[model samples]
Target chain A: MWKWLHPYADPERAYQLAGKLLPWFSILALGLILTGTIWGLMFAPTDYQQGDSYRIIFIHVPAASMSMAAYMGMAISAFIGLVWQIKAADWAAASIAPIGAVITFIALFTGATWGKPMWGTWWVWDARLTSELVLLFLYLGVISLYASFEDKVLAARAAGILAIVGVINIPIIKYSVEWWSSLHQPSTIKITEESAMPTEMLIPLLINIFGFGMMIGALTLVRFRAEVLARNGMRPWVRKLAQEQGAA
Target chain B: MQFESISDFFNMGGYAFYVWLAYGVTFSSLAVLVFQSVKQKNKVLKQIAQKLAREERLKQNRSNNESKT
Candidate 1:
């Protein structure tokens, strides 16, 4: 079963695979995000209460959710690296750290901007908000830990441990609003039950969500390819790639 | 569709500042991320290429010196 994946565990094969998939993800991200945001901002029905201020939801919700998703992906990569000792997995985790951090920042920033109008304040120390902030810090911590060590192996180990440990925060962030009374509203999009939003508004929002996921995937692949090159600089394939790149 | 005119659309029913600000910053950040990722890959490739070229030159010079000796 897992034998098929063994080939991609090689750095060169993984790099080529990422390269092949990058364009599709990028194209889908571009198309979906454009359609979603345009429909959302211009065509979606205004909220009965929040009015057009809710237009920010087109982006805010996508960024907010994808941030957590990116973290989960990072943690999984870290877990794989720790257990299987796969260098590519460690590279993938490292590649995801900065991207996840940026998405988390976007989520927090957009949430704050949205909060200013809806909640009459830029920020509050609410459970949901605070936990998300800690998520950002966890991303930063993993990044710094990865950068701190002289030995690459040790750096990966440290960062992987931190990423794995940070998994505990994901559930906390997810359930914070429910577990504690907070200014933040509960999730608008629900998996099991009917969403709070009507279909007109929810369609574009869902499209944007998938768009953000593809964007994150494309971005991660780009960074992961770079990591592969940097890590395998001395390898024959990497050197050949460098030569080809120079010639091109 | 939601607005009466282009200006009204731009206004975003009095929520333009918040809406546009969030969109502007978010999109710009995404653009920067794309730029940085491509730049990083190019930079790594350039460094590796340069290192290889330098090594090749060193090897040639060593061979030349040995032949002269």
Candidate 2:
């Protein structure tokens, strides 16, 4: 089943593949996010309660959801690196950490901006909010662990373990609102049941969600290419690439 | 359009500050990430070039010394 994925385990192939996908992801992300933002800001009907302030939800929800999704991608990469001993997977995990951290920060900041008017406060120590904050810290921890050692194999091992252990937080972040009487509202979009949001409002929000996912994918590929180059600096192909880059 | 005028849209129905602030911060941060990633790739490539150049010079020196001996 996974035989097709074997070719990408090689750094050269992985780097080239990421390069091929980057443009598509970048173009799609740009189109979808622009369309979604315009439709959301101008066309979505005002919330009966929050009014225009609810527009922040377009960015906040996407960033919040995609932040978790990026973490899942990172953890899966880390697991693959540890289990299959694939160096490309470790490079991918490293590539994903900073992007995940940035998206998580966007989520928290946008949530705070949204919270001020609706909740009458910029922040609260509610379970949902706290867990999301922990998620940011977890991403930072993985990044710092990977950077702390002189020996990269040891660093990757340590970071991989941390990332694997941090898998417990994703479910906690997802269910925190339901598990506790929290200030953060339960999810408006549901997969198994009808969403509370209307079609006009929900459509742009969903588009932005997917747009954010593509943005993460594009950014991850950019960083993954860099990681591959940095890791394989001694390889003949990398030297040839360096010479070509120098000439260009 | 939800608003009748450009000013009204800019005002964001009286949420101009918060709404624009959130969008501004989010987009700017993403822009910064893009800049940093491209810069990192360039930096790595430059380092590799420098290392290769240094190795080439060392090889030249070694050959020169061998010819002298």
Candidate 3:
């Protein structure tokens, strides 16, 4: 069933594909982030009670969402690598960890900032917050585990196992609000039905979400490409490709 | 507009500090990500160049030694 995946197994093919994908993602990320932030801060009408303070949601929500999304992306890549023994896939997965960890951190940090104003406290040991914190640890664990090994193969497998195991926390983070009465708000953007947010607020939130996703995508590709180059540095093809691309 | 005046806009109805703080931190973090990625790519390129140059020097040394003998 996965027979069509052979082309991507090659780092050279993956590199070319990554280059093709990044520019579009970068453009979209830049466009959406700027438009979303401006529209939310200025153009979109403000909350009757919260005033401009409500504008913080534009960045806060997007950062929080992408933080989780990036993790899922990495875990899936790791899982594919482990099951299929695809070395390139494993490298891509490992390459994505630091970026994902940083994104997760932004989520928690920004959440606290938003919390201080809206909830009247900088922090509360709420389920959502706690689960997000766990998510951050999971990311760090993967990075450290991957680095700890002397052999690259052992490192890949170890990190892959951690990624797959740690993914159970993602759902816990997602449902933390619904499972308990927490200070952190429930998900505003729902897929089962219409989102609860009004159109004025919703539009900017959606744009920012797409923007953050694009930015993550672009960053992941650039990082993944670097990984491919490093691993394939001794290969005959790496030099040929780099020279032809004028990178040499 | 949520505020009555420019001052109110800046003030954020008394929540300005936390609100602006969130945005400032978020934007800075994203900026750092972009900066680091560029830096990483450049560093990798430099390392690759250094490796290639060293290999060339080693190859030249081997050739010179053989010719001298």
| lDDT (10s digit) by residue, model 3, range A1-248 | 46687988888899889989989989999999999988887777877776667788898788788889988988999998999899888888887888888888888877887777778887888889999989889889999998899777889999999999998998898899999999987888899999987998999889999999998888988888888887777777766655554344
lDDT of 2 by residue, A1-248 (tens): 47998898888899899999999999999999999999999989989889899999999999999999999999999999999899999999999999999999999999999999889899999999999999999999999999999888889999999999998999999999999999999999999999999999999999999999999999999999999999999999998999888534
True contacts kept of each: 0.72, 0.77, 0.49
TM-score of each: 0.97, 0.97, 0.92
Q: How good is model 1 by TM-score?
A: 0.97
Root-mean-square deviation of every model: 1.3, 1.2, 2.2
Model 2 chain B: weakest 10-residue lDDT segment is B38-47
Residue A21's lDDT within candidate 2 is 96
Distance (Å) between predicted and true CA of A180, model 1? 0.7
Candidate numbers sorted by TM-score from highest down: 2, 1, 3
TM-score of chain A of each: 0.98, 0.98, 0.93
Q: List candidate 3 segments past 4 Å from native.
A: A1-3, A240-248, B1-8, B66-69
Q: Model 2: chain B TM-score vs. truth?
A: 0.88
